[model samples]
Target: MLAVAATWSRLAAMEFDHVIIGGGSAGCVLAARLSEDPHVSVCLIEAGGGGDDIFIRAPALIPAMISGRPRINNYAFLTTPQPGLNGRRGFQPRGRALGGSSAINAMLYVRGHPRDYDEWADLGAEGWSWADVRPWFLQLEGNGRGGDDWHGGGGPVQISDQSAPRRISRAFVEACAEAQIPRNDDFNGPEQAGAGLFQVKQFRQGQRKGERCSAAAAYLFPALGRANLTVLTRTRAERVLIEAGRAAGVLVRRNGRRRKIAARGEVILSGGAFNSPQMLLLSGIGPEDELAAHGIAPVHVLPGVGQNLQDHLNYTILHRSRRRDVVGLNPRGLVRLGRAAGKWRKTGEGLFATPYAEAGAFVHSRPGLDRPDLQLHFVIGIEDDHMRRLHLADGYSCHVCALRPQSRGSVGLVSRNPADPPRIDPAFLSHPEDLATLMRGARIMERVLGAQALAPWRGGRLYPHDGSDAALAADIRARADSIYHPVGTCRMGRDEMAVVDPQLRVRGLQGLRVVDASVMPRVIGGNTGAPAMMIGERAAAMIAGAGGDGGAKAIP
Candidate 1:
């Protein structure tokens, strides 16, 4: 295996010690960290192309990135009709290239609450409690505040506040304080509940010509100089090749051509939550009955392979200000765009900045809970007039989401072909508890909206404020959408629902690991980008024994 690795290193060709499935957040981090050792060959496969487009680099141009002709920034997918949402179909957007969702999502650098992973460790995913993962977070980040025991100074990923975009961002923080929520210094710090400007995964590309750097732009770019890394974009993994129930290789397709390659050591699936489980199910590793339906022999009848689907449920309150002044996205909105360009040219600081999701917080809706049951993610501007579809009028939206939902769904195969999208049912509002939390969440949204600070921006009731809990229950049923934080499916635990062990190895297959959000025992409390990136960092070190102290860090 070492000789082959050397041969491949010299030839700059196949046979990798680690084959990462997706070149998104997790895969990119793994590829960069693992390939640092030229002795080990690393292969990263991305179904999407490299993100060189200008829209991807700009923090404010995210929607335009997703709604373009090529749609190169995203892998657009539609879920099977969700029965819980009145059988309404939902849209699933996964990032296509180097940064994945980090490439397309509104750049919000939130690191959820510490209690989330602590609970995961308590639930069964050992060595994964907050204490174990926090170091990796600090390791990958070059925080704006510089290095502390909690953060690193010279990491590849650049994390800072939008330079000139701080005005509106500060306004967001002031409004949160005026509302009596008490400003919390850092969402990524000890406590998670409160409103403050969010940290962003942004960098000063240059005075004008630099591409706004992203995770892939940071982690993957530095590693590109290494000889051991071979990154193939637009090459999608068809299935994991299992030889006698042990992982051996993978089948991938590019430009209508199919090819096979062997993994001398391990085949790691970092395809996030949705595609990871879908690929596993397509490879005959899901429930026995589902595999039989597709006429494929079951490799392992893991009933939970695609089960336990969950995501943050969001409620948007749309308001039309009486001042006739557009908060965002109007003819006068060119000011925002103008600022982005001017700052991009002058100081690498402006609206091109990441004020997209500047202020946010976590809170327990009804109170008396052990932790915050809901998280508030407030954006000051209005991007799309409506939800999922185009808007009929001018308005700004404030979104509140139920953080830790009890509702569960599943992902399954639509057909035997891996090219086709798998059936995903996020099944939002499926449980009564989830419904109650979200309804209370709507009340919290109103409280924040009606605060004295918002008096200057207050308008008539925007979307729905008059509905009763029963009526709001129906309204929530009508329009509660996903903030796009999906997880579980390939859950990590010791129970039957667990598809991977605490070490993250596939239960029935040797040399195979699911090292992405798919293995999360449950979704974390905030945006998943940080947690997912941290997972990649830890997993790569574990696989290669390459980091500080070869021993796994213990959770506090």
Candidate 2:
């Protein structure tokens, strides 16, 4: 390892006001926001190349981006065999590009339930309540719905309605209504209950048409010309350099060369939950025993560095359909896709403009719950095993997840090498209550699919093999997996085990902070991308000394 003095000398010629590790969703936002000051120099380092492929820009190619082996833009990590999942190893596909998962995700723009943020406040993350964080959400969103108390009209991120929603998609929402679930025009509105179509991160009203608005597109690319900001792609951060109890710099590797980048103001880790905690542990900031086992000397024995891992585990229910227009793997669907592509090239308004899971719902497992515990994603295509398998028949699938899982897992170091993937253990369904909730959700979804509103599309049940709750439970244990949302590894709180404090600063360190999904005290009740970007916005305000922190000094 390079000594602090040596590292400082090497980077003396090019020190930055803020060195942000990981040019993912949070890092891009931070780099964009902080460089706006003009006086503060910002550096953003990304492990993957600039995510600018045509496939990345198209909203309909999400399956191709996320469903496969590790590629140039994907970090396909496999979890340790999950006991809760019947010894099945879960496949996790995190974006390895500049925009992170935002570049590859389905582009749903959900803010999650307001109660999620309020619960963060209750769990020692003061000033993170729905009331406190709502403004930040508005500040980051350029919602096509126009500026309202619930949304903003002019911001970096574009929130728009689906361009060419399928008739089957509308039927799913109507089916939910037939099953007694109310129709919600806006999931981010006053309440989160009910079923509706999801708004996405695509261009709503522009010549750009149906292009995706990822974090890089929304925040990073527009700010590229700013002299104060420097973004380095395909550079992997190896460790955080701490000297005399303060974060001084970062050790990184690019093009097979190791170098240190000094941060004059602060070193912020914007890596997502999996990577952020792994970086901490690799840099000797985790549990003493774990570090010693890896032959790493502990710098800060924060046992909570990789603990409290939580993710939304979901199971999908597939049904066959007789409709020929519906997308599938058959020759007719391929021909339709080709025609859609051609139409997209000209009009940008066709079947190619929509994301796969076009509609969704949030409902309770039982009556009188404070909030909905179950979430649904209605896909217009059959997405079995993350679309790794292409079903020949035209069909649709419904993904149901227990919004807030009770099981807690961890991400740990497999080796000292930064290039090696971290050990992930989401421990899906370890908690009995989680399984019960999922079973209830599956039952509720069955009713919705069976509703008369879907008679035109529904053919026959093709999943779980049987409807018995016992068989469903067994199938869940066998087939349940992540919906791609993982958080809470480096949870923010005031407890002794909390990795970061309410201000998002590492509790036992100075001049260092974590501003990503890892700092969530608990995973939000909806998709995590929007919440992750919201955290980035909030972090920028705190760093610029212009936001609330519940009395904690946010900046060094």
Candidate 3:
């Protein structure tokens, strides 16, 4: 209950040209891009501790950074009851550090689908079509694939092929070929409708600890020397300060003490999808009735501030192998462990480098489908989606995800308290079209497993088939959920409910804007990380009044 304005005088000095809140993926990009000006002072505030851990930096060491595992690096936020999932409270694990989820995620670099952004432009987010966003994606990626019209060559983030491939990994790609699905050299390439290798964030040295080039390591670390940028770690933003009509500052807390940061140019909330809207609601910028119920007066009644929440719903299928498969334990983990240690100690090789999924593809459930409706990730371990954990059995698993569902959900405040988790109702299966598409994807998976080549290798179903369309549909509806990509809250549009305009500015507020996944009008057809970074990269150019070059050269 501290007064936000009362604490401003006791805190650190005056205004910054830009105050970027939540130094995660988008915030780090903004800080890096804007500070290139060397004139406009920028202040970046992150609630979590420094993202400086060896385990997080290593691409392979990422899975080891688990939450609720005592020393894991993440914030465990429980969701309000989800009415759609039989009143279940979902576990939303968000990173609490500089690079954000990019530091702790699986590091799979996916650009999603071109049509995904086309939907954005179609929804009145002008200049957000596939053509407009394609350049931004190219600007940030330094893939080993070399410079293409589609991808950049010498960008900060290194998108390269994984160092080592699991034995079964190569077979998965062959399996796709046997099933009539083509093999693609790149998922981010012109055609995204085939199975191939997925590009990852990796260094030439391979899975070395503390060397994973995350956004902070890639963009912000190099930009930190700029005198115009100030990075404040462990500072949690409580709410945005919208005085009269413009967003002037933010109410923040550090070391159990409160403070305020007033922004002269803009208070940009790059807190991503979950937090951007959550922060907005806490600052009395949401639906009229919701704000009034919390005893806070709404400054601008933006009904769509926390609406249009969307995420990919996926179900994994696991099968036992006929031979010493990817999941097949050598019966002596001690021997395998000894060999892996030997390899790493000698040639700097072994299982420590990669964990399958070295190859996969996005495919249509059937021919003539406009886009690839299913995305498959072939893991070496037996991962059961329904249980949300690895299986006890020794077998490899395949995660067949429904790329785009017709379902729509929402993320909104359950109470006035910012600490309280929001109610996330991603009403899956509520839409008939979503159910049909997912079922179709499931059938496609069945076809892949039923392929003649895989017939000899296929074992008993780990997720047993119910056989009935009604029953299979029920299993999918109950189990399939997010691939950790949640977006579109505080969606951008021209409608009355739109929270942000085409320029990513707040509809009714000045000096405040959101440049993150929260501005997506709909969930993209693929993973959202690449596109979210592009938004930050492109938005930086617009805000700086410079053309779309981040070359760090002097402005003409």
Candidate 4:
């Protein structure tokens, strides 16, 4: 009886011209860009609270922030048991706030290799080639190093050099050079096959210094005062209210009440890979057999709604650092951090201002590969089990992950309940080639660690102390897990399994689109945040009746 009453209440409605579900990384960008035309009313819904928490703003607090209580801003999801990792369930930490995972991420501003976008174009995501999307990437960036042919100026998201990187990070880069990897200053430059320090998506000037420039901070917060834009936070969107095979509005739950907010223009799903596919499935738009099994009348039979799940599975090589100054957890390092915090509070320039994974490398597993197949994240602290285990001593770690995994999985509905979390099975390491590539990458990591530059600080190996390939492979199978890059659930392509087309419009559906990491045909070579934002920028241009020229251009 109560269910029927709630259903009736959910039917009570309001309307907007553009309703964007999920005020996340992509949603924030869409809302800001769409609301630029004041004539059009835009609504953005988020499942979490404001992104103004101090923990989220501080770059050094990312590790502590993600593990904090209330979990209002962090959807600390756990993956299903993977046969790859010896049946161990991996931890998936996705941000629930306005900025989404960008709020909780390491703030690395890696745009991935250009070949990654070229591959997307080849895979049927037309107009998304490296040349086509390069301008869009420039259009969204407000780089601190000024404008160039490859970068932009006066954009929203600020990409700045690390304010203060640890000496160990420098050593990691030098060590990579010693290991035969070239030192490339800019990973987003003409080439992406080397090692260097990473830039961050953070401000380097004015009042926003020493703070993260999340999507909420960069795009949504500034656009909040606009009358045409309505940002409803702490509200969960249940499902898209599709009427007569067309998306009409979204039914959302807030303050113990359900209301339908109609979309006159289009309903865009920006809820990411996990939530977006779940939303579509809940709306009866997934596999017909699965919907019937869950007692749902199918609205659209899209077999690939939650298919093609891909992620970068990484294994860490930990070593106790001989120097306390090189790591963050030791007593000496803690004192330095305490002093750095005071300096950051005053001048916004200190050790506390930089994300710890400051330096990394992208290398090919073999000689014939056109681009890098392996990526390395060198951290100045032990990050085993996602930092759940804290060692009292000084230590550093290197994480190696296969850039492109052939393994695929699925996200499915356990039941018809909208509040229930979806079953995420990222069948990590299902392919033999993926594990083999990771094993090869692990050997490269060992080589990097053994380089002359890192020898002074490197102590005894804390993980898999053995130096043989057989032992390393055993350790990889026991511990390899996700590095937080999950994508390709609602793949965009011309294939029959594709959920969305190249225009980001959902196939076999009208008045609907999906603009997020979920629409990625395949996972990119680097981080997903920058690419996800690029998708948002391009999606907004498409919706505004413009082609690919809607964003703030470079000032020539």
TM-scores of the candidates are: 0.91, 0.96, 0.90, 0.95
Which pairs in model 3 have colliding backbones? Answer: none
Q: Candidate 2 lDDT, tens digit per residue, 152-202?
A: 999889999887899998999999999999999899999899999999988
Model 3, residue 305: what's the lDDT? Answer: 78
Lowest summed-lDDT stretch of 10 residues in model 1? Answer: 1-10
Task: Give the alpha-carbon lDDT of every model.
Answer: 0.74, 0.87, 0.73, 0.86
Model 1 / residue 74 / CA error / Å: 1.3
Q: Stretches of candidate 2 above 4 Å error?
A: 1-13, 70-72, 549-556
A best-first ranking of the candidates according to their TM-score comes to 2, 4, 1, 3
Better of 1 and 3 by lDDT: 1
| Candidate 3 steric clashes | 0
lDDT of 3 at 445: 72
Which ten-residue region of model 4 has the weakest summed lDDT?
Answer: 1-10
Number of backbone clashes in candidate 2: 0
> Between 1 and 3, whose TM-score is larger?
1
**Top candidate when judged by lDDT against the true structure:** 2
lDDT of 4 by residue, 74-150 (tens): 88888889988889988888888889999989999989898899999999998999998998899999999988998
lDDT assessment of candidate 1: 0.74
lDDT measured at residue 308 in model 1 versus the true structure, 0 to 100: 88
Residue-wise lDDT of candidate 1 within 1-556, one digit each (tens)?
0011122224445678888898888888889988988898888888877755667776667766654334657776777777767777776677887778888887677777787899999999888888888888988887878887767777777778656443434555666676667788677876778877777787744432224556687788667767778877778799999887777888988778777868988888989888998888878888999999989888877888889888987877766654433345565666656655776655666556554666776777876777677777666555432223544334456778888888998888889998888888888877878888887888877777777666665666545545677777777767767778989988888887788877778876778888888888888889998888888898888888764333222211
